[model samples]
Target: MTYRKKLIEVALPLDTINKESAREKSIRHGHPSTLHLWWARRPLAACRAVLFASLVDDPSNDLPEEEAKVERDRLFGILEDLVKWENSNDENVLGRAQAEIMRSTGNNPPPVLDPFCGGGSIPLEAQRLGLEAHGSDLNPVAVLITKALIEIPPKFAGKPPVNPESRGKIGNEGNWRGARGLAEDVRYYGKWMRDEAEKRIGHLYPKGPNGETVIAWLWARTVRCPNPACSAAMPLVSSFWLSKKTAKKAWVEPVVDREKKEVRFTVMTGEGAPRDGTVNRQGATCLVCDTTVPFSHVRAEGRAKHMEQKLMAVVAEDERGRKYITPTEQHVVFANKAKPSWRPEAELYGKAAVNVPLYGLTTFADLFTNRQLVALDTFSDLVSEARKEVYKDA
Candidate 1:
């Protein structure tokens, strides 16, 4: 049987589906796509509509004009039900729609395949419409996401996902099945990982000066002064403001001590207009030797000729949204012990036709500070430990 209903005829109803899908996207409370941020994802409604239209036979086909009109109305009714099922996640309606498609296609619809499934939207929609779906992507992150969306859930459908921490205890909470136990295990392990990470390096992430919990910390790249006579290094940050709040504004100002040949960072706070001079987007001038330093001199420029300095997260924001920038003298004192030697994932290439050495960032690890690395490593190790403890036999 061939589909005889023109796609344009169903465009009106599809418009309704599109709008509802857009609304769902804005507040996706339990959507599977929210698990990971994927680039250039397609709309699920469009995927569903395309898959349904392709797989099912058009109702107006192989009928008299009078009967075709009746069939057309019935088809629209089914489309309305499909849209309703998609919005409400009603499996029964979905099953009935799938059965209708199977009947139309003589139960011989081919399994759908998406080779460049960045976020598995098409494959997921195909599966929702009761079609066997397969997806693949060059990106490992995308592959993992597609597997989680299209492979894992169905494989462990009836089975409860119980990690080691909640395996035995979940039974006491009454008939914990399917994803419920899995969610419990996730939450339990999540808290455990955080606690373990904090226990190891909590001191490094200091609270805000206002006695509020620290929300975020900002770091900057540092480089040594080119002048050999005054070999002083400083953080090459453009701006030091942690908050742009009109009344609660705060920023860091560099106090250059020409006599001592060093720069001191002071955190100034009050209700005042933003000082344009406070932000130095250009390369910083050396405080001691009165030498102009460009960004190229501080970054990884050539073979073993790059400036050496530790990365420090010197600025922080509190839970109350107050800003606090660390004093340069006090913070830089810890620099000697805070050396981070994390390597790059891959060598960065420059756009220049000439082959430049160490043109840009080389590794992912080189981007973070010592304390951040420590925290990340600790958290990673704890996750591995938790997994091993939970799934030792499996």
Candidate 2:
């Protein structure tokens, strides 16, 4: 039989049978010819097999070595290029997938949609292929990126406007100021406080050349806020404790006992006199904002025990003593006793906001659009009519 005839006969009801199950059946039946034909039709399936074999099979096997290396190289090369593009610019996988589909469909690319369009890959590719592409994504970033990639002039390629003076600038003197400003605006305030404190107390907490002082500098300089509002100010908060002897690296209040000439630290509970081990009393105030938390909030040793044990004990006792007092009277009694006499004063550090870029891609539903599918169904009819108009002899 001809290749086309054999293909039609041996296609194996792919529409009804799952590909994996069908592949397994073929292998069990020992139908090498059918397997070869199936592999030939699905290049992606072959690629996957190559990947699996490379991962599972022995490396010393000589015959598979060259093929394995080739497959690995091909996969890595594609991934590397994709990653480079993503890193340098704001492109995404959907755009790449849409481009592949467009290339497969020739110059007249089909309209595409990306339901989960992340970074707008498919729709952008469809637009480039002269097809109207629509996209949507759950992520705001994805939607924004897709719209930007699709709307921007192809010449611009979604790159930011270049600053001539800023180009090729590196190191602290060149572009460092701007980068540092961004870091400070979005990253460094907490560290700044810790550093100022350490400078004042480094002598009390002395170490080798790369000792406690250096470590403290590194630690103090790296502190950041955990709340997203403060994420823009810093990536992470610095470690305050010089050693792990302190309980679980609590936020500590640090103070210089000027009379004793010794630096001391305490767990910051945002409450009454620093816990049992608290040594520091001087508080650190924010310079950018007027907020002042005990230096403890920034310290590593300060425990975050916001509630007092006595208060909890009183609450529990009241709850257990409910039989003695009526519900209405109980509430009044609890209210009077629950009021705190002294509360710790911790100031709110200003939070920073950071902007993230997003991308757009395509969805399966786009390929099955009522208008596009209708167009495909009637395509042959339109071609036949055109042919009849042009030629009388056939």
Candidate 3:
């Protein structure tokens, strides 16, 4: 058998491919990154180009050097078109690339396999080129994201919107091609889930004092001061800086009251946020008695259930985009009242991820507040219920 090189073994127009790959991570419309967070997501554009190059020959079939150069340049032109994010769904562009693959493999192109698939980039690209795509992974989350991407879409490609509201609006406006119908249903039912959730647990998240919608709550993990004379609730905040935007600079400043033995947090804006934080790997500094608190003491407090969380600041959306404010009594009250039924309890790994277990946040659920747990459990339930609704509509 004569040895013949593929385009992957030859020129690949790499610089153009790299530019396209880098742009895929941006928050542009309809990117797969918007679908889910998978740290191992490969660049779909790079996957598309490489998969095609792997299959198609490089015109190395004993042609004259000049003729081979011409043919190679032609394939480079096709790859430039194929590797584009905009041309991903361009049928003419994809059809030409697939045709070349068929021509090379004698119309019996082998199915693509991604044995370690994370976020389904490779198989998704394989399916883009009209090839049978199979993906598998040990991580269940990866498997779920991959299955949602590769298994579901093609099954109903070119189908019309099934939901009644979408059908009512999509009346006589041509077929709902690709995943347009499905995407519309997603928008519709995603809104439904959100509305339903608000009705159930809307009060858990309250508006700020001035009636601004609360965007976030900055929390500080706390342990009692090691100094027996001071014994104040000392905060374990890594950073007090909330926002560094020149116009909206914000941070939490701790106010120590000597007479009351209390540490109250104040939300401050503009020039003077504290230069240093409360805690680092070695230890923390108690603001009250000026005692150096050791990490070992913090761990002891956590083990003894003496550690607590304090509301450092309230982030709210206002006319000015965002504003940091001191936490209101009402906001703190609502947070403690949440009674969620279920929580995931998984032990932490020391060297694998973070040393959280040392601080007695032993399980995954222990890391979140009760209100946060309620929201998580609510969203998880709604997803299941929403799936049933999609099925009924389908």
Candidate 4:
């Protein structure tokens, strides 16, 4: 009944837990982990395993050794209940776990603290194991997330949302009560916000031929040929491949109309489509006088084209999922208008802010067009209004 035996019990079920966790991924649509994209968040399984292991003690080889052995056996039964509970949300198993935790560690379990809790994974798992958990982080965002997980929920325990939506079968079956109803409110409001945003800024994001919403826009650096005779600027694009997959593979071939002194992005299909080796391999040549241009001239020296208005690809999504479309010259107009107004200060608190000035990026808002700005501003206003409304109702 040493700590080694206790460790074995904890470690034994991990393989099954890991497999179940991996399977849970496909059905984790409403999981709190998906609420926000936190960087380097620990897996729920690891946190659960470590917390359970630390909470319980093994049999002591002393006067109370026999009593300790009996408690340890009961704890082992609780461990089994925990494994079952993790796999399936059995209320009976949870009850058994709670009873065993109280039996082994008395009514008050020792509190677990994670000071630098980035995503609040450890603390959340600790709380799930029926332990009082305290978490903190230097980052305001992290702090807010931890509060949402640990502090906020318990305050509203056994209570439904202030304005609970009609849950039909989910509510009738006793599934959407307590904290679950609060989650529903969040989802409801979230959808409302998304719809509001779309109504305001839908013009900025256009639909493709299949009516798929645009998800991403790609851009490339452009440079001018230094050869004085040519004096022409061209895009420093290495590859024009939309995709490498056989089914939907496509590419853009630069049709240099020397007579017209222009280059056109012609979508190539079928046998004409370039393979990986040939794709984007060609260097930019001046449309006017056919002189080679260097990428260094474009990126470092700001040669040839206008700054920050390069549109390369328009990625769209629908029922079939995402597809990349080669953007025409017309699409570049929307992005070119998104120039920044103010530049960041060269120094902050006497230290050189080298990166900001080096890249010439002013602010996050500076990277949008006037229309986009209006749309974003309107959405922000709507969100503020909605939040205030929610708080008032609450």
User: TM-score of every model?
Assistant: 0.66, 0.22, 0.86, 0.72
TM-score of 4: 0.72
* Cα displacement (Å) at residue 365, model 1: 3.8
Error of 4 at 218 (Å): 1.5
List, residue by residue over 25-105, the lDDT tens digit for candidate 3: 673455644578888678988999989999998887757879999988988999999988888889999999999999888
Q: For model 2, what is the C-alpha lDDT against the true structure?
A: 0.33
Any runs in candidate 4 off by more than 4 Å, and if so which? 1-10, 58-90, 164-177, 230-233, 236-296, 299-305, 328-356, 366-379, 391-394
Best by TM-score: 3
Q: Which candidate is the best by lDDT?
A: 3
The residue pairs in collision within model 3 are none
Q: Candidate 1, overall lDDT?
A: 0.63
What's the lDDT for all of these models? 0.63, 0.33, 0.86, 0.61
Cα error of candidate 2 at position 58, Å: 26
